[model samples]
Target: MDVIVSRSGGLAGLWVTWHVHVDEQPDRDDWYLLIRELPWEEPLPVPPEPDRYTYRIRCEPHEATLAERQLTGPWRTLVDRVQERSEPERGRPANGSDRTRPPSSRRPRRGC
Candidate 1:
Protein backbone atom coordinates (compact mmCIF):
# COMPACT_ATOMS: atom_id res chain seq x y z
CA MET A 1 0.00 0.00 0.00
CA ASP A 2 1.48 3.30 -1.14
CA VAL A 3 0.53 6.55 0.58
CA ILE A 4 0.94 9.82 -1.26
CA VAL A 5 0.38 13.23 0.30
CA SER A 6 -0.40 16.13 -2.01
CA ARG A 7 -1.02 19.75 -0.99
CA SER A 8 -1.04 21.48 -4.36
CA GLY A 9 -3.93 22.98 -6.35
CA GLY A 10 -4.42 25.73 -3.79
CA LEU A 11 -5.92 23.10 -1.52
CA ALA A 12 -5.93 23.94 2.18
CA GLY A 13 -5.68 20.34 3.36
CA LEU A 14 -3.72 17.15 2.97
CA TRP A 15 -4.67 14.42 0.50
CA VAL A 16 -3.76 10.92 1.57
CA THR A 17 -3.46 8.32 -1.15
CA TRP A 18 -3.49 4.66 -0.25
CA HIS A 19 -5.22 1.37 -0.95
CA VAL A 20 -8.28 0.17 0.96
CA HIS A 21 -9.53 -3.40 0.99
CA VAL A 22 -13.05 -4.34 2.01
CA ASP A 23 -14.64 -7.73 1.35
CA GLU A 24 -16.40 -10.73 2.88
CA GLN A 25 -13.17 -12.58 3.43
CA PRO A 26 -10.52 -11.18 5.77
CA ASP A 27 -9.02 -8.15 4.02
CA ARG A 28 -10.70 -8.65 0.65
CA ASP A 29 -11.86 -5.32 -0.78
CA ASP A 30 -8.88 -3.38 -2.08
CA TRP A 31 -8.77 0.00 -3.81
CA TYR A 32 -6.74 3.16 -3.79
CA LEU A 33 -7.74 5.65 -1.09
CA LEU A 34 -7.80 9.42 -1.42
CA ILE A 35 -8.43 10.92 1.99
CA ARG A 36 -8.69 14.68 2.00
CA GLU A 37 -8.20 16.67 5.19
CA LEU A 38 -9.78 20.01 4.52
CA PRO A 39 -9.33 23.20 6.48
CA TRP A 40 -11.48 24.09 9.45
CA GLU A 41 -13.39 26.67 7.47
CA GLU A 42 -14.20 24.21 4.69
CA PRO A 43 -17.55 22.51 4.81
CA LEU A 44 -17.65 18.82 5.38
CA PRO A 45 -18.80 16.72 2.46
CA VAL A 46 -21.73 14.34 2.57
CA PRO A 47 -21.20 11.16 4.50
CA PRO A 48 -19.87 8.28 2.50
CA GLU A 49 -22.31 5.57 1.52
CA PRO A 50 -21.85 2.39 3.56
CA ASP A 51 -20.15 -0.38 1.62
CA ARG A 52 -18.02 -3.46 2.20
CA TYR A 53 -15.13 -2.31 0.02
CA THR A 54 -14.52 1.42 0.65
CA TYR A 55 -15.48 4.21 3.01
CA ARG A 56 -14.63 7.73 4.24
CA ILE A 57 -13.99 8.99 7.75
CA ARG A 58 -13.80 12.41 9.33
CA CYS A 59 -12.44 13.06 12.80
CA GLU A 60 -12.29 16.12 14.98
CA PRO A 61 -8.71 17.24 15.75
CA HIS A 62 -7.73 14.36 13.46
CA GLU A 63 -8.63 11.28 15.41
CA ALA A 64 -10.63 8.19 14.42
CA THR A 65 -10.85 4.42 14.66
CA LEU A 66 -9.63 1.93 12.11
CA ALA A 67 -9.86 -1.27 14.18
CA GLU A 68 -11.95 -3.18 11.64
CA ARG A 69 -9.87 -2.07 8.68
CA GLN A 70 -6.65 -2.76 10.58
CA LEU A 71 -7.18 -6.51 10.43
CA THR A 72 -4.89 -6.49 7.40
CA GLY A 73 -1.66 -6.11 9.45
CA PRO A 74 -0.06 -5.23 12.76
CA TRP A 75 -1.00 -1.89 14.28
CA ARG A 76 2.50 -0.85 15.30
CA THR A 77 3.64 -0.94 11.71
CA LEU A 78 0.99 1.58 10.79
CA VAL A 79 1.80 3.97 13.65
CA ASP A 80 5.55 3.98 13.07
CA ARG A 81 5.12 4.68 9.40
CA VAL A 82 2.85 7.60 10.13
CA GLN A 83 5.03 8.92 12.94
CA GLU A 84 8.23 8.77 10.91
CA ARG A 85 6.63 10.74 8.13
CA SER A 86 5.23 13.34 10.53
CA GLU A 87 8.59 14.02 12.19
CA PRO A 88 11.11 16.74 11.36
CA GLU A 89 14.12 15.70 9.31
CA ARG A 90 16.63 17.50 11.48
CA GLY A 91 18.77 14.51 12.60
CA ARG A 92 18.95 12.75 9.29
CA PRO A 93 21.85 13.35 6.92
CA ALA A 94 19.45 14.22 4.18
CA ASN A 95 15.72 14.08 3.69
CA GLY A 96 14.55 10.47 3.03
CA SER A 97 18.14 9.16 3.16
CA ASP A 98 18.07 7.09 6.32
CA ARG A 99 19.78 3.77 5.68
CA THR A 100 19.27 1.99 9.00
CA ARG A 101 15.56 1.76 8.63
CA PRO A 102 13.25 -0.06 11.01
CA PRO A 103 12.68 -3.78 10.69
CA SER A 104 9.36 -3.10 9.07
CA SER A 105 7.61 0.03 7.76
CA ARG A 106 4.42 -0.88 9.65
CA ARG A 107 3.29 1.09 12.69
CA PRO A 108 5.32 0.70 15.86
CA ARG A 109 4.15 -1.48 18.73
CA ARG A 110 1.90 0.32 21.17
CA GLY A 111 3.78 -0.86 24.29
CA CYS A 112 7.20 -0.44 22.74
Candidate 2:
Protein backbone atom coordinates (compact mmCIF):
# COMPACT_ATOMS: atom_id res chain seq x y z
CA MET A 1 0.00 0.00 0.00
CA ASP A 2 1.10 3.55 -0.66
CA VAL A 3 0.00 6.61 1.21
CA ILE A 4 0.50 10.24 0.33
CA VAL A 5 -0.41 13.32 2.31
CA SER A 6 -0.16 16.82 0.90
CA ARG A 7 -0.70 20.06 2.76
CA SER A 8 -1.24 23.36 1.00
CA GLY A 9 -2.75 26.83 1.24
CA GLY A 10 -1.25 28.11 4.47
CA LEU A 11 -0.14 31.70 4.97
CA ALA A 12 2.65 31.25 2.44
CA GLY A 13 0.49 29.25 0.03
CA LEU A 14 3.16 26.62 -0.33
CA TRP A 15 2.63 22.95 -1.04
CA VAL A 16 4.26 20.27 1.09
CA THR A 17 3.99 16.56 0.42
CA TRP A 18 4.95 13.37 2.21
CA HIS A 19 4.73 9.83 0.94
CA VAL A 20 5.10 6.35 2.40
CA HIS A 21 5.03 2.89 0.91
CA VAL A 22 3.68 0.54 3.55
CA ASP A 23 5.84 -2.33 2.36
CA GLU A 24 8.93 -0.24 2.97
CA GLN A 25 7.99 0.78 6.48
CA PRO A 26 9.14 -1.21 9.49
CA ASP A 27 5.84 -0.56 11.19
CA ARG A 28 3.71 -1.51 8.24
CA ASP A 29 0.94 -3.03 10.31
CA ASP A 30 0.61 0.07 12.42
CA TRP A 31 0.30 2.21 9.34
CA TYR A 32 -2.30 -0.09 7.86
CA LEU A 33 -4.32 -0.01 11.06
CA LEU A 34 -4.33 3.74 11.06
CA ILE A 35 -5.34 3.85 7.42
CA ARG A 36 -8.17 1.43 8.03
CA GLU A 37 -9.52 3.51 10.89
CA LEU A 38 -10.03 6.67 8.93
CA PRO A 39 -13.56 7.68 7.90
CA TRP A 40 -12.85 7.26 4.24
CA GLU A 41 -16.47 7.13 3.19
CA GLU A 42 -17.54 10.18 5.12
CA PRO A 43 -18.06 13.41 3.29
CA LEU A 44 -15.28 15.93 3.25
CA PRO A 45 -15.82 19.19 5.10
CA VAL A 46 -16.66 22.45 3.39
CA PRO A 47 -14.00 24.44 1.59
CA PRO A 48 -11.09 25.47 3.74
CA GLU A 49 -10.95 28.80 5.52
CA PRO A 50 -9.16 31.64 3.77
CA ASP A 51 -5.40 31.46 4.30
CA ARG A 52 -5.77 28.21 6.24
CA TYR A 53 -4.22 24.90 5.29
CA THR A 54 -5.84 21.97 3.53
CA TYR A 55 -4.83 18.35 3.41
CA ARG A 56 -5.23 15.85 0.60
CA ILE A 57 -4.74 12.21 1.52
CA ARG A 58 -4.45 9.34 -0.89
CA CYS A 59 -4.17 5.68 -0.02
CA GLU A 60 -4.47 3.53 -3.10
CA PRO A 61 -8.14 3.44 -4.08
CA HIS A 62 -9.20 5.87 -1.37
CA GLU A 63 -8.67 9.60 -1.31
CA ALA A 64 -9.90 12.49 0.76
CA THR A 65 -9.55 16.24 0.83
CA LEU A 66 -9.86 17.92 4.21
CA ALA A 67 -9.95 21.41 5.54
CA GLU A 68 -7.37 22.24 8.15
CA ARG A 69 -10.00 22.44 10.85
CA GLN A 70 -11.12 18.92 9.96
CA LEU A 71 -7.75 17.43 10.71
CA THR A 72 -8.06 15.68 14.07
CA GLY A 73 -8.01 12.27 15.73
CA PRO A 74 -7.24 9.51 13.22
CA TRP A 75 -6.79 11.92 10.34
CA ARG A 76 -4.29 13.94 12.29
CA THR A 77 -2.47 10.86 13.48
CA LEU A 78 -2.15 9.41 10.01
CA VAL A 79 -0.88 12.65 8.52
CA ASP A 80 1.59 13.23 11.33
CA ARG A 81 2.90 9.71 11.11
CA VAL A 82 3.38 9.85 7.35
CA GLN A 83 5.17 13.18 7.54
CA GLU A 84 7.37 11.98 10.35
CA ARG A 85 8.37 8.75 8.67
CA SER A 86 8.76 9.98 5.12
CA GLU A 87 10.96 12.55 3.45
CA PRO A 88 9.45 15.91 2.66
CA GLU A 89 9.02 16.44 -1.07
CA ARG A 90 8.78 19.32 -3.53
CA GLY A 91 11.83 21.20 -2.30
CA ARG A 92 10.99 21.30 1.40
CA PRO A 93 14.12 20.20 3.20
CA ALA A 94 14.29 17.87 6.16
CA ASN A 95 16.58 20.25 8.09
CA GLY A 96 14.01 23.05 8.11
CA SER A 97 15.70 25.23 5.54
CA ASP A 98 13.66 27.61 3.46
CA ARG A 99 11.33 25.81 1.06
CA THR A 100 12.30 26.18 -2.56
CA ARG A 101 10.35 25.15 -5.59
CA PRO A 102 11.58 22.34 -7.73
CA PRO A 103 11.32 22.33 -11.52
CA SER A 104 7.96 23.41 -12.92
CA SER A 105 7.07 19.85 -13.82
CA ARG A 106 7.18 18.94 -10.16
CA ARG A 107 5.16 21.88 -8.95
CA PRO A 108 1.72 21.06 -7.56
CA ARG A 109 -0.97 22.61 -9.67
CA ARG A 110 -3.71 24.55 -7.93
CA GLY A 111 -7.22 23.05 -7.76
CA CYS A 112 -8.33 19.51 -8.45
Q: What does candidate 2's lDDT look like per residue over 11-55, in tens digits?
A: 666677787777778988888788888998894665748778778
Error of 2 at 77 (Å): 0.6
- Candidate 2 displacement at residue 79 in angstroms: 0.4
Task: Please give each candidate's TM-score.
Answer: 0.17, 0.77
Error of 1 at 105 (Å): 23
CA lDDT of 25 in candidate 1? 21
- What would you estimate as the lDDT of candidate 1? 0.26
As a TM-score, model 1 comes out at 0.17
- The candidate maximizing TM-score is 2
For model 2, the stretches where C-alpha displacement exceeds 4 angstroms are 91-112
The window of 10 residues in a row where model 2 has the poorest summed lDDT is 103-112
lDDT by residue (tens digit), candidate 1, 18-87: 2221222242222112122222233334233232211122222332233224323323333333334543
